[model samples]
Target: MELQKTSNGHHDLSPDRIPENGSPVTRFDALENITEGDTFLPNKSNGKIETQFTDFVGKTSFGMSIFNLSNAILGSGILGLAYAMANTGIILFVLLLTSMAILSAYSIHLLLKSAGVVGIRAYEQLGNRAFGRPGKILAASIITLNNIGAMSSYLFIVKIELPHIIQGLLPDNSDYWFVDGRYLIIIISVLVILPLALMKRLGYLGYTSGFSLSCMVFFLISVIYKKFVTECPEEHSYNKTVPTESIYNSTDGMCEAKLITINPQTAFTIPIIAFAFVCHPEVLPIYTELKNPSKKRMQKVANISILTMFVMYLVTAIFGYLTFYGNVKSELLEMYSKKDTLMLCVRLAVLIAVTLTVPVVLFPIRRAVLQLLFPDKPFHWVRHISIAVCLLFLVNLLVIFVPNIRDIFGFIGATSAPSLIFILPGIFYICIVPEEQEPLKSRPKIQAIAFVTLGFIFMIMSITFIIIEWVTGKKTSGGH
Candidate 1:
């Protein structure tokens, strides 16, 4: 791989070929190569298909694409969703979630439309083609920030939940450093995450990843089951530290939570929902992998993935919120006693899922950073290991210093997730399908403008809201 300098004196990250795969680079073509709106009428004569743009072939089926994409969309963020609901009450949370889901779907539409027009599928390449180096750099930077923040959240869960598991199983709980949360995070990172993170490809880690997904399901079931079966002890072990009971009222054998409330913390729902639907970076890769790639096929995959994740998130959140109500913590698992038999299974599964996920999330951040810093260089083992070590160290420091995962979610959700999910897609659509040639009443133009305007508002408000949150000392959650 060589960094090709464009005619206009800029570094082109979209290389023509990759020696490792002995094939053309993924999605490095210009939009002029394909006819507009004609989504992949592949030439399949005999058993062979023709792709003149590059020798690379896609073997992933449409259904498989949906599974892959849904896995991407559902990660550690689900843990904090109840926290989000608790922050913005049930009513406002639902409204924000619906709007964000719609925006996410439409953003994907714009991205696919633009990429389809140009036959480009890489996220950074799309930016380069639409705008230039600045655009490409910006795209890469946002990916790094959003992905790193996401990975941090995943590890932060490990930091919080793993300690509970360890203490529960351990015969010794007398302030040993081994059982401590801070040291345990580093130890887990070394013993478990490091090896998994070192895996060659995302496909190699599939079984563990799938198992982790199963754990999240168990977590949902545990919440729903425990809500009815288990009654809270008069004194929760951490009751003194976590004073959340006072926030809710018991009325008619149910917790009384408001449907809507507009406090400083309510604004956090924006970033939380924004981060929830953020799998945009993975969209292009999955699009390229579809057996007979087409924007329509990819759109189907995206829709299925989005709907599946939305259902999963909605049920998990509703159950978790209903169970904990006023006592809901940032991470839902923290709300439960470590000794509960049902929740222990949920804990082990989720802990496995989240710890395994650290590596999965780290892959994109490393890739994005490499694209930003070293586009010309091919994969080097030394560089890969070094980068992974550095990233894990940085994440460890963050997890230790930053006790709450929700804060990381809020910050990253506000800053980078919006740009990738909303703004860039709208901008790319405007560039590819120019309004200058379209009629004044063109629906696409109107929709694109509206999308951009909505994106701008989301971005601005998220930042402003977070700033206000920091100033008021209600940085992580609504309560404290």
Candidate 2:
């Protein structure tokens, strides 16, 4: 039997023959015996393998996994997804979705590789191991800032939709926008999100998958029914003529500069399009939940999630774009504002779904900030601070600069969108994993070529759009 040493430097009796005192013993000592019942007994000292395996299965499941995945993909940005697709044309939007999905899958694969080799769980941890403490700080900062922007945008949406919905119910009350309706709505939103935030672990909300998925499916069905069954006014025809010049136009030239403006190169740089498809980093936590956490299972989940998102976004974008045609606005609800009952119902459903789902997006940011500032403290207080801070910022933004939601989407896309979606994953993948542990080392030459090529492409496109927006002095008009 093997001997074991405790932290106090005491030699403990072997497990094969228990001491009369019944002290703890190590697994190596227990392994000396090969009895039938012994296989079922856990090692006296530690049960790392058993516990990890059980946790993996418990943590990973179709419902919760999908909810987390969808939570990451669906955010305030979805409000503008339909409009962005309409602007670019249906075919272009579909192509972009496809490409983005593939790229996102590739990025997740890289992340899984790094995580497996280094035993990293969080994105910040992976960043620290790969690029240094600075990398961790940068990665965490980007995610936090992006989430803040996303939450603020959500608040902006609630402020806009809630007041309008309430006023519609009470047409005589034009004062709904002023007489604490905004404040009430903000309070209601905070209350709804707070409970979800207060949960000590995401596992507690795992049951929410069915509700969230139902909301999503119902929302989609309503949109489809509204788009196909209801007949829009003749004015909504696709062939409708648009005014050549307007105050909204920033350029002096005619608005219709090109019939089919295909910037083969810049076509992929559309902000909202990129925003809709980039959600890889958010999927990192679920890797450990898988029963096996094998590379194959990871790839399957990644592929399935991406495909599902692509199909959902494609259908929604196409239908919304077709319904609005040239009159399309940035927010999908605008297209249904004056439409029949069915259309209005769909718009309201989608708004509710998005509002309810806001807290999931905010959770990650809260966790990241808590890890950074008070890593050693109980995470519950950190969650409280995060909720408070989020509510405060959201309320202030709603009061001060609740500009057009469309423009807010653009601003988020311009600033934090690219960094969160593309830059961070690519950098971490390349830098974090040791050379010996890299799974694709056999094809290092080809892998290097592809990595550099894709990395450079993403970097150049993201940087260029950000720079152009800064230089053009253009301000996005509020409310799509």
Candidate 3:
């Protein structure tokens, strides 16, 4: 037994006594008996520790993890993807999105490879392995700011979309606060999200994950219907669908159709797409709960989730963009006329999907906060509830102030998301898992170094461009 210090004071943190039943996360043996020069894992025969999520151990399956991770990856950020496509244009939008998805998958590979190399699974722990305490804090902070920005995006969707849906359903309503976005978000947090957040284990959330993804699929189907089947008003409706050739042949309505246009506004695509694919923070926890956690098995889970989300993103963006063409709004559904029954149905479905996802996003944010504040503390109801309330309050506060999702997604995606997706993973992989003794001369290390350097450049350019757009008062268009 080792006495782990907590706000409540020193408590026994026995190596084999994890709350997650039937788990073999006995690595705490190293923590309990750590010597000055002890390797993070003692007597390592192989570079792996089979992880079971500390609270939900042995209860999640490979398929369950995939659905949950897919839910995490495909967030309200998808709402703005049509906007991204509009800005980047059709050809470039598809290319950029595809590239970002590939890079995101590669980054996850690096993260998992590094985890296997060092016998660690947690994102913060990977940082600790690479650069000690500061690295851990850095990782925690990135995840914190990134998630807060993301949570705010979710609530931002709720704030903007829910009111529109309610008003659309009852157009004659004259009540102000009755349909106010801030109050509606408060209601949602208290009712829908609070119960899910309060749950002690992640395994139970899987059932909800299925429902959540289904809602998004319904939303996707609705978009396709509105584009091809749902009758559009004369102003918003197209006589014919925009063909691939017109995009290939022209550049007006086919804006951003060029291989790559160098507009500052479209540069925001890096973050939006980055934000769309950011389930990295949740991957390890999901991996821990995987039925037979291994680098190969977990990597497979990651691939399937990413690939599935890529398809969803591509389909949703194309159909939504085709429906509105150059006029696609940041929130795709917002682009549709309010009275259309099919559009209303689409809006309602999306509202439900994003609403259910709030707690899923909250789970990792709470975990990161707890790990940072009370690394060794047992999960206490008081602490858990307090943190959950604080996150809800804090995120909602940001949501209230932030004008829209694009700015939120653009800012966080440019600054924090690149680090989470590209820079940090690259640095951690190079530092922790040196594939060659002279990693300085090693091909893998060189590639990682290039990747991190590119990530920084990408982040810097994105922020600079977004700021320029703000200064110039230029509006961004949407895409792929």
Best by TM-score: 3
Candidate 3 overall lDDT versus native: 0.71
Show model 1 residue runs off by greater than 4 Å.
1-30, 33-55, 61-64, 86-92, 231-254, 257-264, 377-386, 400-410, 434-441, 478-480
Q: Which stretches in model 2 have alpha-carbon errors above 4 Å? A: 1-60, 176-181, 230-269, 288-299, 378-412, 439-480
**Candidate lDDT (C-alpha), each:** 0.68, 0.54, 0.71
- Of the two candidates 1 and 3, the one with more favorable lDDT, higher being better, is 3
Between candidates 1 and 2, the TM-score winner: 1
Per-residue lDDT over 373-423 for candidate 3, one digit per residue giving the tens place of the 0 to 100 score: 887776689988899899998887777875765665667666887898889
Give the per-residue lDDT digits (tens) of candidate 2, residues 1-480.
Answer: 333331112222222223445444443223222221122234354635231211123346655666666656765455556655544555566677677777777777767665554443467666665565676677778777676666666566666676666556556677554435468555756577667756655545555544665666676676677677645445544323433222233432221222222322223326556667656545655664544455567667777767777777777766665555445555666656543555455555656665555565666676566546644444356556565566555644654455554444455545566566566665666665434444444464246446556655655665565456557753221211
Cα lDDT of candidate 1 equals: 0.68
lDDT of 1 by residue, 380-454 (tens): 777778888999998888878866656665676676877888788888778766444554358887788788887
Cα distance off (Å), candidate 1, residue 213: 1.2
TM-score of each: 0.80, 0.74, 0.82
- Pairing residues by index, what is the TM-score of model 2? 0.74
Q: Which has the better lDDT: candidate 1, or candidate 2?
A: 1
